[model samples]
Target: MDKFTTLTGVAAPMPLVNIDTDMIIPKQFLKTIKRSGLGKNLFDELRYEADGTEKPEFVLNQPAYRNAEIIIAGDNFGCGSSREHAPWALLDFGVRCVISTSFADIFYNNCFKNGILPIALPQDVVDTLMEDAGRGSNARLTIDLEGMKVVTSDGTEFPFELDPFRRHCLLNGLDDIGLTMEKADSIRGFEEQMATARPWI
Candidate 1:
């Protein structure tokens, strides 16, 4: 996981609601436990044709959105199955933050763990950001996690709420394993004591 203090980059507008985990990476691509290389398969059904060619009509295939780092999406984003691959693909594709009116609970939690910032704002706020994202390459959005603000290219700022604990983890690049590693000394000590107390086992 990478630290996510601040990010300023292209924002792609995805207004479709109920973008499930399967849509993000598709079921066929879920066989691998590895997180890398999934970006190419991200939105496989929508981004690629049945012949495995790029879909020109897809938002991600558009030249302006090809390198989009932020996503302004519709309500109920990340709905459906709880597969963690969705966030992995998005992160690999360079999306550091996602701004939506709402998100599914499991997916929202997974984003934090995977170093992706999933922001929930009011519908009006999302609408404004979505419009800004539509301005093409000239319009860039800034997401400052420490400041909890998303600033549009035109200088409009919108504040969003995030759990303090999740914010701390992302700022420090700490995933579940990272969090455990933070208490390495204590864990080691506990193991030693257990070994000595139960030598027969």
Candidate 2:
């Protein structure tokens, strides 16, 4: 997991609603437990054709958005299925933050665990970011997690709400495993005590 204090980068505009997990990485690519290789297949169906050719129309495939680090998306983003691979694909593809009017509950939670920031903002605010993203790669957006605000290239700033605990986790690059590791000494002590007290077992 990577610490996400602040990010300023290209933002791709994806206005499609109900973008399910399968659409993100597709079902075929879900066989692997490893998270690294999925970036090439992120939005596989939308990015590539039946013959494995690139689709020019998709936002990610476009030249300007190819390296986008942020995504300004439509309402109901990340709907359907609870596969964790969805966020893995997004992260691998260099999307550190996603701004949307709404998101599916499971996916939203998953984003925080995977080091991806899923921001829920009002529809009007999302619309503004989407339009800024529409300006292409040159119009980079700035997201300051510590400040809890998203700023457009033109200097407009919008505040967003986030759970304090989740914010702490991301700032420290603490995933579930990372959180557990933070209490390594306590865990070791507990195991040692258990072994001595239950000698037979």
Candidate 3:
């Protein structure tokens, strides 16, 4: 996981709602446990035709959105299965943040764990951001994680809420494993004491 202090980059507008985990990375691509290389398959069905060629009509295939780092999507984003691979694919695709009117609980949490910021704002706020993202190359949005705010290219700013602990973890690049490693000394001490107390085992 990478630290997500601040990010300023292109934002792609995805107005479709109910973008499930499978859509983020189709079921066929879920066979592997590795997180890398899934980006190529992100939105596989929508990004490619049956022949496996890039779909020119897809938002991601457009030249301006090819490198989009932020996504402004419609309501009910990330709804459906609880596969953690969704966030992995998005992160691998260089999407550091996703702004939507709402998101499925499991997917929202997964995004935080994977170093991707899933922001749930009011519908009006999301609509504004979505419009801002329609500007193609000029859709530069700034995500200030520490500041808990998103700034549009035109200088409009909107504050968002986040759990303090999740905020802390992202700022320090701490995932579940990283959180455990933070108490390495304590864990080692506990193990040593257990061994000494139960010598037979």
Give one digit per residue, the lDDT tens place, for model 3 in 1-201.
799999999999999999888899889998999989999999999999999999999999999999999999988889899999999999999999999989999999999899998999999999999889999987699999989999999999999999999999999999999999999999999999999999888
Top model by TM-score, which number? 3
lDDT of 2 by residue, 1-201 (tens): 999999999999999998889998888888999879899999899999999999999998899999999988888989999999999999999989999988999999999999999999999899889999999988999999999999999999999999999999999999999999999999999999999999888
Candidate 3: where are CA atoms >4 Å away?
none
Q: What is the C-alpha lDDT of each candidate?
A: 0.93, 0.93, 0.93
Full ranking by TM-score? 3, 2, 1
For model 1, the superposed segments whose C-alpha errors exceed 4 Å read none
Q: State how far residue 47 of model 1 sits from its true place (Å).
A: 1.0
RMSD (Å) per prediction: 1.1, 1.0, 0.9
Give the per-residue lDDT digits (tens) of candidate 1, residues 106-158. 99999999999999999999998988899987999999999999999989889
Q: Model 1: how far is 178 from its true place, Å?
A: 0.4
Q: What is the lDDT of residue 37 in candidate 3?
A: 95
